[model samples]
Target chain A: MSDASQGASALTPEVKGIIGATAEKIEASFPWGIEREGLRIFTQAIMDPDPRYWDDEFAAKTKFGGIITPPIYCTYIGRRTRPGADDPITRAFEENPYSDGIQGVRTPETRGGLPNIPTPLVRTLNAGNEIEVRQYPKLGDRIFSQAKYADIKERVGKDGSRMLIVTTETVYTNQNDEVLCILRASSIRR
Target chain B: MTTAQELRDKKQTWWDDVDVGHEFPPLVIGPLTSTHLFRWSAAIENWHRIHYDQSFAVYHEGLPSVLGQGSWKQSILPRYLKDLCLPDGWPWKVSFQHRAMIVPGDTLTIWAKVTKKYQEEGLGFLDLDVGMRHYAETCPGRATIVLPIRNGKPIPYPFVPPKKLSEQTS
Candidate 1:
């Protein structure tokens, strides 16, 4: 076939090793904690004014039972303890020379102020996402995540470039085996 | 003191007499940081170190912080459409394309304009061009949504065939 396909096929072995190694590392420790403050930060960032996330009284009356976190709040549930430095995604982009153009802090021309993060990376573009929620986590709930590299493969687009497709699956759960959410995402490394 | 009832009562519906060119309400989002990025990673079960570790980000490719997830941007679209349209406005189809990255502290303004309206099979459909613009640079992403008009009935499935076929001999 083409060079891209051959390159992708050659990567299967290496990708498997990476996935297995990363899964073992993540499963061994609880990387982060889910808390109310984190919930507020995430919800406010999205500009969601739902009382369920802000007011305890209104949340109590809703079907959610109590201070229920927003559905999108699931994005911020993890905490990392080890490296004790910059965020992992940022580091991934910074290290890769090909991605430098996409990552960095930008200025808002209209507002005339510093952007929230001094440097932002548009490094990883969206390949696709699948989300299934079993139950919503309420305020004060403690949760953990099990992350693993699900699969990796390659494809050649009509443009003739070999693209590496990496798929990862993460399952979130409470102290009980009750699944909170299951997220599967794919990224393209070209 | 203003009561929650007053706040809830102030919620507007699309039926409250809307103008075609009027802009939908504006929304401010993010003073985002690595913390939020990490939380998103943990919640999404993404262990990509770039989101939480600044050193990894800077040393590796030189990013300021972990990048925001693209799916998060896509998910925000439905909510924006729901807010702009009335409760009776039901979405039939939605398509999105991510043209740029949304980092922490980016204020996004989401708005939509009713483009076309037509009646098909006793159902009313409004075509909308929905958009999200980064207030800082005016970089925006847009989508087209086919939504059902308020109080309109849904079109029935298995529409009659347009033409009759000739009888076949067994």
Candidate 2:
């Protein structure tokens, strides 16, 4: 915990400015691609319950034509893996000071999650989630992801404090750029 | 009472007969494995190693196996609730807190009780305290669902006039 506190205070003005500038530069690179192995690793991490993921025979029986991936798997695909490097999740965890696991304290780069944007001084919360499934990914399919800073707005909640809500929209496509899923997530900052 | 009369008197609605002390119907789900995680990951495009790489998860996070994503649990809640409630029964609001870790192979018994029921805005809403317990340990997540009263019509939103009343009248 103390380590996280130290990391939080280390964000100097220069670092903040650098990250802000970088965020703009990165935004232009809208969509990115993910490796097949990386995608495999992440699904395993979340521990999905459905057997169609595990049993080949059962998966073949389903309409998906083979094993299908879970809905939330898009969150990890095609993210920049390192800082000033391109990987989205890695950059957030490795770079970006002030990423102490608290909302609004960490930038998107510091959030260490895929399909996350680099934003400063905001806390990310699961406002809500909606999933629409067109088709599920088959085994060994390389996924491509396109991410953009979708929206940022300010509003006053019932208690009357100004809050900044930032949304990052990412669309996942297959190697052929076929649309797979669209993820729209919002994070709150004080 | 005669057996035939008793049979006729039985309540069909879960709300009418379910008691506060009653336990929810048990649902057994999964012996989760790496393949399951892999498919889920590929489907969601998740690349996190903690999910699939058991060595990394155990050494780094001190977990026995990959931890289930909180979102997956959220998705399952609807299914569990639906099994207990009727087809048209929809939960208005659900709030859950992650209390314990749920891994593959852990058989969880999801339980809920009807704590209260009331009418608000002309809709009958049932408040339920729901939980999931595995191996006698409960997780932090709990949910509250609002069920519409049977045979009651849902309220329609009031219409908003395009122009002010004064303008229309004038």
Which candidate achieves the best lDDT against the true structure? 1
Least lDDT summed over 10 consecutive residues: which range in candidate 2 chain A? A20-29
As a TM-score, model 2 comes out at 0.44
Candidate 1 C-alpha lDDT tens digits along B1-170: 12335433444343324444545565445556666666655544455556666676668858765667665565566546534432234333334455666666765666666665545454454555665677432323333223344565532221111122101100
> How high is the CA lDDT of each candidate model?
0.49, 0.47
Model 2, span B86-148: residue lDDT tens: 323333333455556677677666667667665555454455666667765443333333344
Interface RMSD of each: 9.3, 13.0
Which has the greatest DockQ?
Answer: 2
Candidate 2's residue-wise lDDT over A86-135, tens digit each?
A: 54444555664433222222234533223333334445565543332234
DockQ of all models, two decimals each = 0.06, 0.07
Q: How many Å off is the CA of A167 in candidate 1? A: 2.3
